[model samples]
Target: MESTLQIMPVQRTSRNFGEYAEEAVIIEEPIIKQKRPLFIEANTIEASLEHLRNDCIIPVFAKDNEATLSHVAFIEVVQDAT
Candidate 1:
């Protein structure tokens, strides 16, 4: 079986509070946006890195999405322990 690498986007938010002079203080809350996991073909650890570099997997995964490779996390490699 071929190995697979799982990558997901990370979200971040900023808070804006009105000045003390302002009558109404605006309190913003942090919002976290999640995206679907992206799977890549990786038969081994080295192959995984090669795919990420040669294939430019970052943009491929970020295409038409706000997420970026920097936000990618939970990189999992599924292999048969035989």
Candidate 2:
């Protein structure tokens, strides 16, 4: 008898959860804006495309280490868009 195995993919949620609201004047008007920070990572460009869709982040800056493995970290700018 033979058995079959099924492989599943990872589901990602929205990592961005930071925003900024502002009011210029008291009796004039109000303004609101949101800051969106994003980080995209993967082994190859093909896989990175999938990460972009899942994480909503574009690979702006990148660094390839020849002696270390890749990793991720959260920032204090707008959100943990990674």
Q: What is the model-wide C-alpha lDDT for candidate 2?
A: 0.47
lDDT of 1 by residue, 7-59 (tens): 98878776565444557689998987877445543332444544655664454
What's the residue-level lDDT of 58 in candidate 2? Answer: 36
lDDT (CA) for every model shown? 0.52, 0.47
- For every model in order, what is the number of clashing pairs? 0, 0
* Lowest lDDT 10-residue stretch of candidate 2: 68-77
TM-score of 1: 0.17
Off by over 4 Å in 2: 20-82
For this target, which candidate reaches the highest TM-score against the unseen true structure?
1
Q: What TM-scores do the predictions have?
A: 0.17, 0.17
